[model samples]
Target: MPMSALRFAAVAALLGVALAPAAAQAHRSWLAPSATVLSGAQPWVTVDGAVSNTLFYADHVPMRLDGVKAVGPDGAPVAIQNGATGKYRSTFDVQLASPGTYKIANVSEGAMASYKQGGETKRWRGAVGQLATALPKDATDVQVTYSSRRVETFVTAGAPNTTALKPEGKGLELEPITHPNDLVASEKARFRLLTDGKPAAGVEVEIVLGGVRYREKGPELKVTTGADGVFEVSWPEAGLWWLEATVQGADASGARKSSGYVATLEVLPD
Candidate 1:
């Protein structure tokens, strides 16, 4: 299966999975590394991948490794092996040699079905395979809208590199002002969220340290963008962190759609 196909599979599978207590507005894909900063004794690291509505939880389904790619510390291609897909998440291991930052990313893009009725518009919840068959047969205003998605994470061996974590100018991208791999729990970290290579204001960003989920009423895990589309948050502790943002816009077909971006940051202990 291809990257888009695998993502669709995970989305379609969500209809069958039990929903969490708090349902997210959209589904996000993520790549999380086992160790953000490797030591001399540790020669390898592992990554977990999944596409689900719930952040940091494999409640829906695991992501496929059909088109996964990893760049080593020295910007060389790293060979990923022993990839295994499970019911909830996918796991892969990467060997570490050089002493810098390693980046692992996944990209998925395809068309989505949308129903435009009057001023109100709604998008299909699942895969494109469930298009008209899963929707009402009498539906008249169905539009095939295009969408692109990308998710990435970083890990450092000895020192972190800012050049390696540069944004790829995707739909929703995070340009880290502070090094993602070298974040400390006591200090605040800043990031600029960009949409189509430009700063996006008023974007909803969810920052979670550890496994805590984002809630609208909670101030600790959620923050919105300002005029510069920049936000800073202090890490509660040192551990694995997940940051996700969502934005809605019209596709090339003039159909209203939504896209999400997820990035996993590993903060060192204070």
Candidate 2:
């Protein structure tokens, strides 16, 4: 393709990423631990990761496990060994030698796109695999927006601790209020969504449990965050849960951008 056409195509992709409706977007990728709480003498925990529309089901494309990291119960790095990427999902194991909360996190490299307008080009960056809508035809090149994303989940060894569940203040983060590792189907799980280290108000949150077939009556449950940046959800059934939030912003240039945040919770049977 010609240089101009190639540039246009790139810009179009960026716009799509910025404006795509929530319902049509791809599933937010996340990592779900096999067990959130380990008791007795177990020193190993496994995590499964995927980019599926549903929760925990590797029905969609597999997520890459290259940059996966695990922090042990003592606030130190845990060994993540034997990572395997399959056609539908990726799996890895963590060696938990102590008794505390473990944190597994992945921050993807930037995914970016740009377009030329009025003889100038603008660029955008978002969570990998985020899609944007087409740029408006009448809009000119006058702004730029950039975004970054990350995913996190926690596991408890021996006893539960909230230390590992604290927000890292990344692009978009969720601070567990109900202890992500201790969720129960009979109770509600509470979380606070934060953006740039401050309470994020009026952001939409979507929680998905297992695949569509696994849901009791629906696919995704949606809720909007209040002024406190907190939201809660009750699992209809015991299973893995995927929570996602997106925030959009624009640089001084007026270029619109967005970032995606994903977290997982393991809900046990009541």
Candidate 3:
């Protein structure tokens, strides 16, 4: 059954799972030695191993495997999709564009829960994989990381080039938004803040718009970020104010940097 998004504590309690309060304080995970690598070049891969049991009732969390440019042999992150009854698989047919050492890794973190009894949540950190070896061997199958644990990667040395056009989707594009001007409370003015080219939420924005050389009562308002990364401030009266947003990331250490864009707007009688 599809799960409804629930609060952290509520989800954990009902799901009979644990939640990592912060990225630093991560939960231990179970990893499986089983994995695959596509030989060649291009994008990077994320290292994954453990059988992460996240979400409401599902035994393992559905994860999309990404690649990293690890130095070792010729390999690229394989394109992946859901296969047969909850199992995810990667398809690599490009045929080792280049033969050299390739690195593999996983860089993702997610959590989900069930909708039964309100909601149950399970939290886990994905297993960190440490696989390294050379590619394009003479044998039909070869092991890269562990000789005792031979993994088979389909790469035929000196194999004939068979190029085929495959349909692929490009990754998403991201941009950053910038603005000028802040709002000062005494002066009446409207204001908004943006981050990463999108509306940022859970941010403490400062308004310092109007008001000039003359001194005025200075008061900073603490505002939480909305999903759209936007908030409206109605001017109590006409004045100037400045605008700025506090930088806060996933961890406490990530909170010190500030990258807020400021725009000035006027609020008049409705």
Off by over 4 Å in 1: 1-29, 51-60, 74-76, 114-142, 212-220, 251-253
lDDT of 3 by residue, 140-218 (tens): 2221110000011112222222121110111111111211112233443322334433455565555433333345544
- Per-residue error (Å), model 3, residue 104: 44
Q: Tell me the whole-model lDDT of each prediction, alpha carbons only.
A: 0.69, 0.71, 0.29
Which window of 10 residues has the lowest lDDT sum in candidate 1? 14-23
Query: lDDT score of model 2?
Result: 0.71
Candidates in descending TM-score order = 2, 1, 3
lDDT by residue for model 1 (52-83), tens: 66666777779988768887755667888789
Instruction: Give the Cα-based TM-score of candidate 2 against the true structure.
Output: 0.78
| Clash counts for the predictions, in order | 0, 13, 56
Q: Per-residue alpha-carbon lDDT of model 2 for 71-161, expressed as tens digits?
A: 7755667778899998999999887777888889886544454556667665544444452444435445424445555778888888887
Off by over 4 Å in 2: 1-16, 21-23, 26-28, 109-143, 211-219, 251-255
How well does candidate 3 match the true structure in TM-score terms? 0.25
Name the TM-score of candidate 1.
Answer: 0.73
TM-score of each model, paired residue for residue: 0.73, 0.78, 0.25
lDDT of predicted model 1: 0.69
Q: Residue 248 of candidate 3: its Cα lDDT? A: 31
